[model samples]
Target: MKTAIKICGISTLEALDAAIEARADFIGLVFFPPSPRHVDGHAASALAMRAADRIGRVGLFVDADDALIAEGIKAGRLEALQLHGEETPARVAQVKERFQLPVWKAVSVATSEDVTRAESYRDAADLILFDAKTPKDAALPGGMGLSFDWSLLDGWKGRPGWGLAGGLRVDNVAEAIVRTAAPLVDTSSGVESAPGVKDAGLISQFCRVARAA
Candidate 1:
């Protein structure tokens, strides 16, 4: 099967266009205020309109409230919700129930134990995103360009569905795909010229490499 690609932290129309041109499966719009890639409701609406049935839009959120999630869903016309914070299984289910959208719970992987922990969300989330863990004091949960050991996922058979993220670039995404056999791959800082700045050339190249793998 072909590995799906998601270009995340897309805040500008240029970045959104790049993802669409690259034929990426999804583009992430961050709603967390602390992240450099965070976009307001109006900005997200414009970007969503520009995307308009061409590609899927996933909204990234921290431990946000229902009101904020509602605003993001309305603004971005999100197809899915990616939870990237310390949310419990119940909360995940609650969000999924409230939004009535496919919910993806991002599990921070630092060890095999962390990988096993993803099972808690198997029933609650529509997908489990395995991402590298960040420091407890760090301002951002992901998009730091930090990767965990891919070997930890060797022969991993956890359900409902899953994907790989963190530190994936054009040069290394092929290796990541081979190692994990992930059905989907996501990247943010790896395809950026600077923090929160998505590079169009890099986006295209990353998609090409990931598909070729």
Candidate 2:
């Protein structure tokens, strides 16, 4: 099977089109207010419309409330919701039931124990995203370009749908796939020339390498 690639934190038409033209499996739109990648509801809706279902459009949210999600849903036709906060299994189930959409729980993996915890989300979430844990003092939860030990995924299997994230770039993405056999790989800051600024060339190269891998 072909490895799925997600070019995340897209905030511009050029970046969105770049990911689409590069055959990205998913395009992420961040909704968090604190991050530089954050996009408002109106902009998100416009971007999502631009995608036009050619690629999956995922909405990234921190610990958001129902009102905020409702606004985002109204603005952006999100195909999936990525919970990137300290949401519990019950919360995941609640969001899935409430929105009747696929929910992806972002698990911060630092050790084998972190990987083990993903099992609890097997039944709750549609997809499990394994990301590197951020510092407690850090303002943002992810997109710091920090990576964990890919070898930690060896001999570990949890839910049916899963993806790899955190510090993934074109140069090392192939090695990551080879080591973990990850079906899906997500990158935010990897293809960016600056924070929230995506480089089309890098996006194309990342997609090429991931597909070839």
Candidate 3:
């Protein structure tokens, strides 16, 4: 199958358009307040409207409450919910039931054990996003241009609903795909000119590379 691409942390219409032009399979709108890429309901609503059905909209939340998730879903018209926090398997199942949308649980990987932990969410999560684990003092959980050892997933045979994230750039995305055999590759800071500032040219290049890989 062709590798799918997700351009995440899109907070502006320009970035959203760039992802659409790049033919990204999914575009993430962050709801986390602490992140530089954070987007409010009004902003997400406009972006979602502009997106229409051109691309899948995924909402990124960090241990958010139902009220916030509901607002984001309505505003962003999200097709999927990416939980990038310490949410457990039960919590993952709960969120899926309450929202009736595909729920993605992001597992921060640093070692083989971290990758193994994702199995617990197989029954609950619609997708398991394997992201690089951040520092204890880091302000954000992801979109920090950090990556874990790709070899850790060399022969992964667990749940098939999984994707790779973190530290992916246009220069290395092809290699990442070849190395991990990731069905879907997600990026946020990789195509950005600065924190939360996406560059249209870079977005196009990254998608092209992933497709060709």
Candidate 4:
């Protein structure tokens, strides 16, 4: 099967076009204000309209309230939500029930115990995303270009629909997929020229390599 690719943190029309043109299965829009890739509701709406149905629109949030999610859904016409916060399983269920959209809960993994925590969200989340753990006192939750050991997923058997994230780039993504057999992969800083600045060539290369892998 073809591995799905998600180019996260797309804020500009140029970046959006790159993801769509690259044949990315999912395009991520950050809703968290603290994130460098964050896009307001107005900008998101325009980007969504520009994308139309060519790519799957996903809104990334971190412990966002209902009003924020509601606004993002309406404006961006998001088809899925990626929660990368300290939200509980109950919150995931609540958001899924209220929004009626697929919810992907991102679990921070640094060790075997961290991988086990993902099982709790199997029933609540539609999909699970394993991301590298960030420092407790870090400024942002993710997108710091930090990566955990890929071998940590060698025998992963938590949930059915899951993906890999954190420091994935064109170079190591093929190796990552070969090792973990991840059905989906996500990237942000890895494909960026600078923080929050996406490179079209890198986006294209990432998709090509991931697809081949």
Clashes of each: 0, 0, 0, 0
Per-model TM-score on C-alpha atoms: 0.99, 0.98, 0.99, 0.98
Clashes of 2: 0
TM-score of 1: 0.99
Candidate 4's residue-wise lDDT over 113-156, tens digit each? 88888889989999999999999899898999989998888667
Please say which candidate is ahead in lDDT: 3 or 4: 3
Q: Which runs in model 2 stand beyond 4 Å of their true positions?
A: none
Stretches > 4 Å off in candidate 3: none
Give the least accurate 10-residue stretch of model 3, judged by summed lDDT: 152-161
lDDT (tens digit, per residue) of candidate 1 on 115-174 = 899988989999999999998888899999999999988757858889999899999999
Q: What is the lDDT of residue 161 in candidate 1?
A: 87
Clash count, predicted structure 1: 0
Q: What is the lDDT of candidate 1?
A: 0.95
